[model samples]
Target chain A: MTTTHTSRAAKRPATSGAHGRHPAKSRQRPNWLGGLVSWLWLAVVLIPIYWIVITSLKTQSNYYLTNPFVPPGDPTLDNYRLVIEMDFPLYFLNSLIVAIGTVIPSVLFSFMAAYAIVRSSGANRFLRGVNSLFLMGLAIPLQATVIPVYLLIIKMQLYDSLTALILPSIAFAIPLSVLVLSNFIRDVPKELFESMRLDGASEWKTLWGLAFPLTRPAVVTVSIYNALQVWNGFLLPLILTQSPDKRTLPLALAAFQGGPYGVNVPAVLASVVLTILPILILYTVGRRQLLSGLTAGFGK
Target chain B: MSAITARRTSSAAASRGGGVLPWLALPALVAFAVFALIPLIGVLLLSFTSWDTLGEIQLTGLESWRQVLTDPGLPHALWVTFLIMLLSWGFQTPASILIGVFLAGHQRYRELLAVLYFIPLLLSSAAIAITFKALLDPNFGIGAGLGLDFLTQDWLGEPGLAFGVVIFVVSWQYIPFHSLLYQGGVRQIPRSLYEAAELDGAGRVRMFFSITLPQLKYTIITSSTLMLVGSLTFFDLIFVLTEGGPGDATRALALDMYKRGFQANLMGAACVIGVILVLVGLALALLLRRIGGRDPYASQLEGA
Candidate 1:
């Protein structure tokens, strides 16, 4: 334990020092090649997004007649209206339910598990085993497990239900969530936990009152990442759920693309925009936290 | 370091008292075990059995394995999957590293650029595939809309172009993420190293190669592992984009599994593919970890 702690301590200052000196270091040299690539990559990244947004607003006929990059001169909500009429709102609601349903339970469970693993500090054989299991879980492609999941869902008589989607999703999310949350929880000072324990605070209380607050950013990060994954998820929903009304936004988007509305390019693009709009709004409002949190979450 | 002692002293108490800490992990354990672990085992078991989409499972020893191994489609699918993984990894790594180094700078415009760069990350794969499909329709897409005959070729209609489009679009979707990872990795490198190199009068490109690239070894492993493993799960994007069209040009293993299990009603064969996918993913992850000389997460915690 001391060895690990000391090693980590040895590395922390170097990174913090680097942070302080980063701006100056970058300013000392103008990275012309990287700058050129950055701007060029920016164009590569933005062109399609720009095209999608503008084309979605265009009338279907105007879409064919006009430049793909230009915003529609007579922008209309007619495409959006078409999407709305196609039960996009319902699909959006289904996605919301699945995201929320999956996020809450999975995050909560992962938090508890992470708190346990961190607090145990590898002393408990059970937790050590569990931690190793999750570590192994990270390497295995969980997507490959979907076929059996589909079978299990069928066996449980939960086929085609939102619950089927939610169940597998929660399971798939656990490995990464636990890994990330444990990393964050391990960062919380053990002295804090010891002090809280001395104050006669129960482990559960310390978990919620102490560790939870200290790691709120991680909680938020994991929540957003998991939400993004579940919201954008397609395979489970495609396999598990068959009813049109039960479709999530991604499924709905695909249906709209492959079906007759597929040829109605504007309407299809409208569905695409509508599906992404909520997350876009979230990104706009919480760009800083979202970006930093995600970077830290995955980067570490 | 004090936390180590604190945790150490408490561990004895924890073991003696047998506290609620272990139980705290039970819910997640159960969830993962039931849904993930069982399915993993089930995929293997089901591979030995036969089941159509609507039929009862019938035990058939070695039949599925025999079928999958003998089928030429399996090799083709595996080839496609490998091609996508290798090409995307090659394309994304350098680009991500460059953009990451660029964005690691403290510039207001870089932040703005990052904001736009991540937009692709937010969009669902299905939505992205749809947008691109329409944007590359050849008849009414960007080519025809802009009257650029060069851009107007059969982008998705032909085998080679469709394959290239898959790789290109995949890079478009994922480069931002890998870039973010690289950016974080870049920012973490000690400034003194760069300063020392600068004092030696090293050029930017020279320093990038000599210092930056070596320092980002772990990050490269991490990003590459993600790219390789994540490619196995490209079902949503490919399924939405081309549906393995243009004469099976893009029918990677994931899509192959989906087609076999869901479309063609070959559940056993699909499970065989699933097992193969799991093996390939684990093999690649382990191989990368071995190359990196440590498990990244463990090394991160231990500060290796």
Candidate 2:
């Protein structure tokens, strides 16, 4: 209930200014506190990332001997070699397979579904119902559904398969993709649809020629967003796949922490670094699109 | 013969102005039904039965719900999960808002800081967990090497600090997300509003309260809902970091669900907790929606 007042207090030191409102004194005041905290936060975020990258590069013995906060006196890439030898590339390929497998289908299906929901209004109550069903799916927590998903996969004989990971993820991603894409699709002028209709374009033709072009930004956004989710998802792969050969990158990384690499922290961290490198590259390139896409419906 | 006739009837119906909508939406609908909606319905029914991963399921009505009610570890788990959620909210929300406010006002390197802070969000929680798990180890960890021996406690081992470390890692992963929300919200405030406030003798702090915070109400609602739901269901990092160990200190509901299903071989019990989790999430979302009154972006809602 106090989310309101508690939020105000969190703003900090505004009570005195509430009455004072002294423009002159406040104008030149730099946000030193903000600056200090932000920089400190930057370090807090970077340290673990830095720790892993440096640790991954260090000679194992040097990693044991050197200050953890300092760069390694003797750098090495042997850990990467060790991880790669341990089928890290297989796991990476599996992750890529699952990611591409999930994203393409999710984006393609949801685009058609959203297009139908948006363009086929007025007596197309079925489309509207489908749209709402997808929206409700948003509230269904993934963790809650894990058991049933596991059971269903096993029932379908897809357990321990990459196809198992791909199928469920594509299903789960549809809700958000539909929501974001439909939002974009609704903004397509109704006149364009009517014009296409008069021009004798089939629903499919207008959908592909007019609506698809208009919603390309959304298509890209949903594609990257779905890719990120599928790439980073751990639970699905954890429950569905049992074999080392079938394990995705996240499952592989989790494995490195224990079992074979338990004693080799650098090797585990090397795996970590390698696992994130591709996604990090993508994020750097498409940071704006990804952020906006993730927060798409939240603006509502 | 039935399948052939059904296909012919579908073509006949489509040619009769039934439109291509159902056809266009068939793929999504099929995917949703088989994978999402059916699984959801299956979980609800499965919660009433006992089953192992490799064995036959037996219907045992009210038993799993009773088990969830009676399980000693569950309350502690729920309590721990709730505490983490509160701490996370306390940890991430205000800090995000403040940092967001600061960045919105600051001109230099704001984007750079945002990008950097978001690193944790991009990387796998498993990766982050492994890195921190190693870093926090008392014997061989960075804590020992950096000579910040004071900062070096048994991060994931000692019961009290293990929970704290979990909270810290959770915060580490999520704070940037809410901050990004705040930054976006702050950007939405019209520049003219700020100028008007300044001319009316409002200070930065005052303008923030009187104008900025008021305007950011919806974003706050949205972010808080996301964070609360996210914190409750949080699993991957905690799973890798502690495995809910150090005497069951970080046993969140999600972890408990995992244990009940896989470790205890009690699939029914896990689903009960899952249902409860869904209920709690729905309740909170509704509660926050009411508190939030009307969404400021209702126009956008209508656009969709």
Candidate 3:
């Protein structure tokens, strides 16, 4: 941090501390050691991403023979073609359906529930109880309840279907979403609701007209966050789905990697790239929303 | 007198409308009850019974629980989990704070640095694990590319070393997450304090101890709580990467539970381990929340 570095430079005797490395003349001097470490971490983070991107472009011959961390000498799009031949698009479509299916219902339900919880007067006990019930869902790890969830899906004959994945994912996603949406809704001015009520606006009208618009940012945040979670989820699909046709991208990728295609390194990397691209695009567009949403939930 | 009567009727209508308002939560409540609460109760009940994943739910009072308690490999799984949490605290937590502090500055590239670092977080854990699995290949891998062949051993091969590399990978995926937490905390420390400290000639080291750390105490608690619980209960990465191998060297409780239930055909025993995982995670979260004192962010939830 420049603040830390500058303060360090100011505090130390110029003869001793200043000469350890570069001379500090700038008012806001970068911590070179910290910068070095940060860049190294940047490299650590990027090299694999670089490897996957470049490897996806390299021929299988060079993929094994050449250094993986280096840029590809000879490149090809055939790996992506092979990945497509493996029905990567089907898996991608399934992931999209799941993400959309999960986000829409999860956000809608959390929004309405958060509205009820926030709008309920202090004496309203039933709504308060509902709020606490959702709060309790926060700590219930999916791993713990997973076996029973599988049983329930089996009982409903929904096992090995996308429905099984979406239902449980929605359930798991609600707690944090509700907590965040409720907090955001609470920040909405009460007078707006009261005036709407006084003006003979139906509760539904007021809710849709005022609350929805006011909390639209929170809506986007929860939608993107939940979509990201559903897109990236592995355990649910792994445990729930059995048929190859129903396997999500995560399951598909893992199976693709370990199957006979394991030797086809570029194709596997291509699968990885294909699976992750949408969410990466989502992150690029909604970085601030995702960060603020999570930090608000955790920080609060 | 007419105004008062009109207000009373409007207020009465408000209460009547509010009666139907609470029913809006029924969908979420039903989802929670069916998916979260029911399964939670099911896991607890199944812990005491004996059955495979299907068929008759034969209740045999503590049989599965007793078996899990007396199992030979239970301690090792737990120990591996504990090592992960400890190593994460040692490795990930400090790095997170440092990176957080660095990114908290007023520099131009801090934004780019942050976006770059979050790449692993955006991608799926399975993908990251698989890529790292290739990169750690001693010959013809990233280690070779960097010309650090001496630096690249069989990183995931040895028994003791397998668990440690898993820790590194775990930290790699998560350090950015905790760094984001700390970066938020660092930004929350008002700029004026830094200015005053700068004027007072209190060095960076002095300010970090005297000002920064004290301000960040609660955040550190939350970050540590997340790191501990998350690392302890990890499964997916290990599952895809090593399949809990070189011979149970990397099998934590979650992995062991999966293997016991699905692989070994011992669903009831798996539920018992699941119960322990739940209780441990719940206990750890609550205990950390306890140590965290009051929820400082509680006041923020009410209307501004």
TM-score of the A-chain for all models:
0.90, 0.88, 0.87
| Candidates 1 onward: DockQ, in order | 0.52, 0.34, 0.33
Tens-digit lDDT string for candidate 1 (A152-198): 99889999889999998999899888887887787787778778877
Q: Tell me the TM-score for chain B of model 1.
A: 0.97
Name the lDDT value of residue A51 in candidate 2: 82
* lDDT score for residue B180 of model 2: 72
What is the C-alpha lDDT profile of model 2 across A104-169, one tens digit per residue?
998999999988776555246788789778867766575688899998888898889999999989
C-alpha lDDT of residue B177 in model 3: 82
Per-prediction TM-score to the true structure, in the order listed: 0.95, 0.91, 0.91
lDDT of each model, Cα atoms only? 0.86, 0.79, 0.77
Clash count (model 3, backbone only):
0
**Candidate with maximal lDDT:** 1
C-alpha lDDT of residue A161 in model 3: 91
Docking class for model 2 is acceptable
RMSD of 1: 3.6
Writing each residue's lDDT as its tens digit, candidate 3 over A66-97 gives 76666786688899999989988898889989
lDDT of 3 at B88: 75
Return the candidate ranking by DockQ, descending. 1, 2, 3
lDDT of 1 by residue, B1-304 (tens): 7666856755744864747888999999999999999999999999999999787899999999999999999999999999999999999999999999888765556777888988888888998898888888899899998899999989998999999999999999999988888877786688789788887888777888999999999888888888889898898899988899788999999999999999999999999999999999999988988998978666545523
Candidate 1: segments with Cα more than 4 A from true spot? A1-29, B1-7
